[model samples]
Target: MSNGYGKKSNSPILASVLHGPRDLRLEIRSVSDPAPHELQIAIKRTGLCGSDVAYYKNFRNGDLQAVAPLSLGHESAGVVVAMGESVQGFHIGQRVALEVGVPCDDCRTCQRGRYNLCAKMRFRSSAKSVPHYQGCLQERINHPAKWCHKIPSHVSLDSAALLEPLSVAIHAVRRSFIEQGDTVVVYGAGTVGLLVAAMAKLSGATTVLISDVDSGRVEYALHNGFATKGYINTKTSPLTELSDKLMAAKETAVDVVDIACADQPDAEGADVTFDCTGKEICIQAGLYTTRPGGQLVMVGMGTPIQTLPVSAAHLREIDIIGIFRYANTYATGIKILSSGVLPCLDNMVTHRFQGLDAVPKAFEVAGRTVDHEGSLVLKVVIET
Candidate 1:
């Protein structure tokens, strides 16, 4: 079978490649048109995410090490430039949010309705898998039509590019099983954390409280209406001088939300909590802030191993659930974006760069907490 790239073009596609740690380069490569089951896409906008920034700076992310030249990017959206004869659902010129994790449908996980866990999953622009599945940082990609979801006309390519990360937030919220009036608390105010807070509100959370180490992000979350209350966590100690600081941060988040809803005694503690920062401290605080029988959903990725409060969890019967990359959430995310309910979603893209030429600087700005002017930048976009 042809690899989907059919006929060769005179001009080679310009792609961003990571040669090693802190080594990013632009290379020219050949690409063919779409094959039988594929659709050729002209990548328009790509979001620079934490994982992508990690791979660029350290040549690794958690367990996924970059052993060879790898192209880095996954959150993206584009328009179909061409399609194979057998492709039925998509047509040329249709705008779409590309789903990067393509799985083997015949696998056990896929058969069980968990394709994200498929053993043979192939992801684009990822170092997790060998022969590194090249990502959509280039001019074009011949992707499976089944993995592409059409974006509504109301949404811009930039918002569609963010659907991938939004999907993760959507999946996390879904896993929490939030009820109409449940109180929710989310740790971290980064891109994913912001989205998680927004999703919690849209999913019917009566009160959503967000906390982050960065004061700017916390203020942004509150000002943008993503969270009902925001707290800036300034403590870094594990124990020494930690008790009071941790309590203060927790109280600022939990107390304010509860105090506002003083009529409901049941709302004293958060019914659902999300650890979007994955730090041991945040995880510990999440456990403490959740009500008995409440659920703590882990969404962020951090150190592989960490200490857990087994006794506290056991006594309170707190359900601690882990969420991997999102599964079956693309459509819901697109719908949410199209609804225009999250008005601040567009403001998240604080910085933008054009074409592969600006990829290096884009990754640089994305990896930094503060920009050149010492201001916080929520998200960065690379437009091609």
Candidate 2:
């Protein structure tokens, strides 16, 4: 801390703290002024994500568990209220998106511009490192100016918060290296999947087919025009046996590809496939539905180990690409949002709750398959 940071704020800060599983308490604490190269942001919007829900319900997201009270939220946007003298290129009242992960700039991965893969990275709201770096669920926070992305003035704060997940889709599409007129098959119609499909179309994919187990989600994707067509994956049965899963995946792939190009009659598979569901069957289906020499991007994370169809991938010479969060996509995401190329961007957030008190309810709704009225629950936003 330096400069004006020594002067503490008299106004108390409000926060929704996660003490444990399903235990979210509204607490008040004093604010800390921004340090040199830091900006104090008044958080305006925070979107609930699957990872956040996982931590709320199970006290863990995959292998990482929260052993201590940790505020859970990272997809967020805010306004700059204060800046340290050392920070330049930013001023007060600026709208910015918080790039939750902070990586060691000196690392080889960071030097290569793949900082998302940096081993020493510390992402907010995550318990990977002890004394977990708190998240953006609070009223105000101090963050490094470099990690804060200035958003376009015209963009909605909801969409600004969405840029975090949108950046992931952007990174996934970038890894695919898709060319114009390519066909893409996306498994999962969730927020990430829909965003990925939308980005794929915007990236010049002639056909973007999205699939999901939920019929409502499929309809939503088609209605939003994010998908050329939607497929309902009701026949998929979770099987413990690897061979059975493979056979089922192959069958599902054939059925899906048959509908991918209805009039073509001979459309074998997609030029690229993305498994955003992270299900083993979905991964296997991606292998089966990708054309020879094509690429399949694993954008979603699942179990550390799963039975994969390595033989098929090796024989077909299909490149399997892996994505970890995102690297260098915030500026591009801001541009995409500001341009309004995707009109559905505004409707991406299907539910809204207000204030820090509603965060718990928002997480509850986010974890549900559908709302009480049976409406499709997409992104849940907490507006402060």
Candidate 3:
């Protein structure tokens, strides 16, 4: 099997598999032919995200732990090599982006068009399921044809891999309940956060402010036109303890919010707020940043349980809405990326490493605030 074709091989192909905390092994794994209603793909690229990094570093993401060794990648794109007899509208050599989640069609959530909330969903590279589904860190794998989306010829396979995150941003923005000329504030300037800010502006928001702990990322959001202004919650004191750090983060969010909210001429606070960091601190601060009767969208995943300022939410009438993955947003992602509405969008993949052997290195780079050359690290891609 090659980067473009996943042919049946007599010998197993190289795969990046995670054994435990800080233990990622390059093993040889065999891939079977596509089952009925499936398509075998030659994975070209996989982009690592915060969840992937958490699994690699802690063997878990939030409360979910890996029960067995698994290949840890979900944001990926590939080429169709072989299609099952039952597969339709697909052919060999066609470019596609893998959605990576397979849901039970009969589930009520799925039937209601909220497949992402289906209890029986098997999301690749996630430990939420008992027997975890394998990810796309290998050379080739078979997936359900219904979950594989064809991409335009102009969309590079590398960028197609990012469609997963783009879908997430789209979902977040849609749930934000943004209105024309509204003041919107986004917390966290990561790839998804930046995308959310840009989409909010395009959705008719007059003021968009993005916040992050990293100064470089905040600046990137401003210079890239993702946000009208950026805010960095700088470190004021050396907080060595976890509790202290979290508290300091919370205070920073408050500071950022206080400053931005005071500038709002039309409302007491932002019309809508986004907690893209998923950190309890960000969530707590959003309660204060958002105006009365405004909405706060939770898009990121953090610790399973944390203390929140429920009093602030109740008194301010802030609607704290949570989003679990994305529901029915892949097509929107494809259209936005195909239209090229975002300039320097491809540059978001700041670091690209070659081969499955570099998978570990890619994760290491993804966790860093700055690259070896002092450049900001946004997204890291592994090319197989």
How high is each candidate's TM-score? 0.92, 0.96, 0.93
Regions more than 4 Å wrong, model 1: 1-11, 237-268
RMSD of each: 2.8, 1.8, 3.0
Using TM-score as the measure, which candidate wins?
A: 2
How do these models rank on lDDT, best leading? 2, 3, 1
> Residue by residue across 221-318, what tens digits does model 1's lDDT show?
88899998876776655564555645654655455446434556655478898999888778877887788898989999998997666666799899
State each model's CA lDDT, in order. 0.84, 0.89, 0.85
Per-residue C-alpha lDDT of model 2 across residues 36-154, encoded as one tens digit per residue? 77888999999998899989998888899888888889999999988877899987889999999999899899999999999999999998978898899999988999999988778
Better of 1 and 2 by lDDT: 2
Error of 1 at 240 (Å): 8.7
Judge candidate 1 at residue 27 and give its lDDT: 94
TM-score computed on alpha carbons, candidate 3: 0.93
Which stretches in model 2 have alpha-carbon errors above 4 Å? 1-11
Candidate 3 wrongly placed segments (more than 4 Å): 1-11, 235-266
User: Over the stretch 3-64, how does candidate 3's per-residue lDDT look in tens digits?
Assistant: 23445544367889999998999998887767778888899989999999999999999889
Number of clashes recorded per candidate: 2, 0, 0
